[model samples]
Target: MPDHPDTVLTPSASAAGVAITPTSASARPRGRRRRRPLTRAGSLGLNVLSAVAGILIWWTLAKVGFNLPTPAAVAKQAGHLLADGTLEQDAMASLRRVLIGFCLGCAVAVPVGFLMGWYPVARALIEPWVQFFRTIPPLALIPLAVVLFGIDETPKIIVIFLAAFLACVIAAFQGVVSIDRTLINAARVLGAGDLTIFRRVVIPASMPYILVGMRIGLGSSWATVVAAELIAAQEGLGHRMQSAELYYDLPTIFVGIITIGILGLLMDRVLLMAERRLTVWQERR
Candidate 1:
């Protein structure tokens, strides 16, 4: 094809001592490309804004008309409780119960869940019972636990243990069953024995699910402990809240609730970090 009259060309070397190039896609000066907004800063700022908004709403409702205490009142009450050592006592008591119960639950659930998943006979014998118990809320067993173990720390711990155990068992069971068969078969081809394959492949692959179950179990333990404390005993946040309710001590109640939420959030964050560390080899979206 011949160049048309409208076609423009530039000389490589000109008499004017300038080397010119054709105006083409490669020759154009690019405009300043827009940078992406910083997501972390935006997210943190948004979270702070949301918290401030929630505080304002709470303040308005409490200050303007509601019978509830304002955030300021709650803060004052929290300060008093802190100074008097009541908050520390209650928080420690609750923490103790949750940790003990959660540990017990995980200790039992993980092994039982793995067994049930690995063996059909175990699954057949236990699955029915697991399903039945899981259907019943942990709170419902409080009366039975109290009757069997007495109203002391035993009953409270038992209820929390049950709450954690059932949830964790299911999670672990699912994790075991979801393991890839190819890995197990490959191990077998490489002369790995059953025990070796299970130890090296099954356990590692199922660890993420176990951690997930532990997180769920931890939450359940906290909830059950609170309910157990409400029913019978002293020194836990639940007990404190229950006592406060008798005198309409709204600020104390708010403090206890907030403390539980904060503790739960912190524990969940720790568990999430653990899961990420353990599952580092697994592909993520």
Candidate 2:
């Protein structure tokens, strides 16, 4: 008998009067191997190193007259903005807009997406509109939004809302549609009702897609808000950048850019954590 099912005995060894037993499956080396993932500390260290390297590159570019401000100069400008409460006010304004629009977008999107995915009638009715709107950039509607909703917070919020909505809805719709039919059939064969299958199988399987969509939507919201603020708005990082651009304030521009990046990164990290927590059963590299 072979040592294992996978083991093979060579005829040459048998002819030589030697029993040639191949290594057991457990003892044999694997054909493919995966590298160990970095520990949390190592990941953090790498992030810091990357940030440092980026700063060094930026400094080098600035020295080469690339019309960029040095990191120290940007930091100094940030301190000045902070001292006068300008940074805080601008940050709060942008944060409020993003939060409200993003939340409302998600609240509406999940249900709508679920409906479209689960019901053929809903999908037929809603999909065309969704695709049409998606092709039209949210920024392009800024003018219409302003005309209809006025040059207030409403228009800005509306634009952001649309951006987030489009991104999240598509993600959710794809998630639901992409669920394995075999799982649904299995559940049905086991005498599971539609509701039971939806609750137990569909929801869990679609969650990863929903979360990914939300992340994409969140990015879209930020982008839209900044663009919306660029026109006829006050008290936002985008508005501040616009104001700075008038006088060629490179340091202030850098500060605003860095602040927005940091805020977005922090929010993204929160979503990532949620994804990890909620989708623990999902395999990842």
Candidate 3:
């Protein structure tokens, strides 16, 4: 297209000693590159905002004459319990159970999942059972687990294990199965045997999936911990909550729920940090 008749195109040599060029998509400044998110700061801000919002709702509802306990009431109860060391006792016991069950579940799940995903015969045999049992809720099996193991640490641990095991197995198995076939082929072409391929290519490739499973399993573990401690538990958050419920102590109930939430959140962040550290070389896709 010719320059418009009204356009006073300057001569190349007479453009104030600078070369003039036609405008084009390439000539325009690229739109400012999207800035990377301030993830830590943003996360902190969001959590703070959530806390503030929750407090505001609590205050508002209490002021509007709701039967629910005020935030102060909850705070008072938490403080009273904390001062008497009751809170710590329960908290520590709960933490102990959670860690024990979670770690054991992951230890078993990861290896079993790896085998299932890595070996054809192993997978064919185990996948059916995994699928079948995974569909059952941890709570649903509580009756049987309790009856079998009794209302001791065994049953609670078993409940936690079920929660952790199912989630982790699924993640680990998926991670292994989802590995790039090309990567495996490349390794094989380079003379990597099946075992070597698994240890090298498969393990690294499946790490993200495994980490994701760990995160998910931790959440499920927390959810189950409450139920696990509901029976034959003398000093756990769940026991305290059940006791509170019997007396309609809403503040204690809220505190227990909040404690669980905070604990779970912290565990998740720790897992995330571990994942990032381990997978530093992998471009997060």
Which parts of model 3 have CA positions greater than 4 angstroms off?
1-35
Q: Over the stretch 151-270, how does candidate 3's per-residue lDDT look in tens digits?
A: 878888888988899999989999998988999999999999988998888888888999999888898888888987776688899999999999988999988887888888888989
TM-score of each: 0.83, 0.90, 0.86
Error of 3 at 170 (Å): 1.0
Compare candidates 1 and 2 on TM-score and give the better one.
2
Q: What lDDT score is found at residue 246 in candidate 3?
A: 96
Of the candidates numbered 1 and 2, which has the greater lDDT value?
2
Model 2 residue 10 CA deviation (Å) reads 21
Whose lDDT is higher: candidate 1's or candidate 3's?
A: 1
Give candidate 2's error at residue 27 in angstroms. 10
Query: Which one wins on TM-score?
Result: 2
C-alpha lDDT of all candidate models, in order: 0.89, 0.92, 0.87
Which residue pairs in candidate 2 collide? none
Give the best candidate by lDDT: 2
